[model samples]
Target chain A: MTSLTSLASSRTPADLLRTSATAVWIFLVVATVTSWALGTDHAFVDNTTAASVVVLLLAFVKVRFVGLYFMELKDAPLPLRALIEAWCLIVCALTVGFFLAG
Target chain B: MTSDVIDAPASPATAPGKKRRIPGEEGTWIFIFGDMCVFAVFFCVYLSARMADPAGFAHDQAELNQNFGAINTVLLLVSSLLVVLATRAVHSPALKRHAPRLLAGAWLCGAGFLGIKALEYAEKVHHGITPQTSDFFMYYFVLTGLHAFHLVLGLAMLTVLIRFASKPEMSRGQFIFFEGGACFWHMVDLLWLVLFPLIFLVR
Candidate 1:
């Protein structure tokens, strides 16, 4: 078993900014702005069920990005990754299902 | 300190024949997933309540300041990014010196989130919009209040992480603890990502 403290190192501060995490952060910010616009009164789109669904879907997608990237689950072992993916899908499906059913 | 002493995957390239690893202790995931399950129930209950009174819920949801929610989302995202960078720094010999500062930055971002949340709560109270105001407000207060409580815990964890970063070396046990704490912080951020839309955005 590889000890937790024995992992290899190759990244620097500059490399950190260029990593997948940074890219995900940018995407997350943009997605948040899009959701904000969709949810606000000033939105160009109508506040219909479709718009609401889009916003909810966008939120959950952002959640997945945070998990897979920021939480470092993207590089995690298969079982752990599978568990989180299942959580995201189940939660998102149930939440959306409830919204649509209403 | 040698790079071998730090914890976590700093390189994109894993060594040949090395097993894929989880980020933190196995027990940590149990708690993380359990807390998530509880919040999942909360989400469903809120949705069910909204279904019963859609019009009232939408009406009251309109009263929420979306700007506050958006800004808070940005704050949390920035904080999460900082935490990610700090964790990477922990794994790099040359970058380890930056870890404490990075964690401190994340702490500030978390503090900013709490500050904004406090302002939001105060504004609601100032306008006489307590939890008793409506079913919507009730869920809003309870859910966000619980989330804020979690954020407070995350901030405390960040403080610990900052201290950990300053240490010259960490034992395998300490590294596992650090990793688990980092995951907990990310869980807080993940919950808010869903909560923001569920409460503030969704019609």
Candidate 2:
């Protein structure tokens, strides 16, 4: 367990929470607008794929926001946070790798 | 006369006053983590199948309505913001009284998400594009169906938390648990953001 002092030493817990929410909202809005403008047509080719990739990257950023802020993983002991994030990343990598290869 | 053990002070192990650590929270996290892995595998399988039949997948993907997907994404992202606000309200003495209302707002947003998704699905099915129509359709139905299930569960958790919001026994820290559940639900929504464009909008 982490010390309360260390937890409080950084941005007050409330500030961190607010910052995370703001960050997630900005990310979502940006992705929505960009994808809409750029992906108006179902190109099915390289352009669409590029747009999709950008959206997916944005998804990754949003997930990080949720995990660190709402899930309170930022305040958790380092090992536990690493374990959770690492597993998710590995699975994600394997997924993309398998799909890209096939 | 034999002395009665009844109503007597219990042994150290059986002491009623001792706070036994509730294992429920930790166990729930494990369950959720496993659930995430299940989704991860599903995503992988969908991705691989899409790669294998890009042309067919592209054709099916074009049938989907990107507008609806975009709207639903906005709804969910907004709901996540509401949940975060609800958690903050729970912690703040000034706003503690409004926490349930904030949570209710979150649930309403979730319902809106489901409603939009329903309309989208209905329109798709009306156009003669069902899950059986193609491999892409299959992934679309399955992935979105899974997300719908999570949305329902998240709403249920919100309802439960709201019920206890006014109770004296509940503490501000209790909201963190609901916040975590909301986070997972948001992740479900966020995943669809990518899936929609990748599988539907992008064709």
Question: Scored by CA lDDT, what does every candidate get?
Answer: 0.85, 0.63
Q: Write the residue-wise lDDT of candidate 2 on A1-102 in tens digits.
A: 222122223333354244545665776677676676566653344665556555555555555666655555665557646755775577546644654465
Candidate 2: regions farther than 4 A off: A1-18, A42-46, A95-99, B1-24, B168-180
CA error at residue B85 for candidate 1, angstroms: 0.2
The TM-score of the first chain in every model comes to 0.84, 0.56
lDDT of each residue in B5-71, candidate 2, tens digit only: 1111122234344233321156555766677767767877887887788778767766677788778
Model 2, chain B: what is the TM-score? 0.80
Each candidate's B-chain TM-score, in sequence, is 0.93, 0.80
Quote the positional error of residue B178 for candidate 2 in Å. 3.3
Cα lDDT tens digits for candidate 1, A1-102: 112233244444675565767878899999999888888766789656788899899888888888888777877898888888998999999999999988
Best prediction by lDDT: 1
Clashes of each: 0, 0
- Give the Å error, residue A14, model 1: 1.2
B38-124 per-residue lDDT for model 1 (tens digits): 999999999999999999999999889999999999999888888887877777676788889988998999999999999999999
Name the 10 consecutive residues with the lowest summed lDDT in model 2 chain A.
A1-10
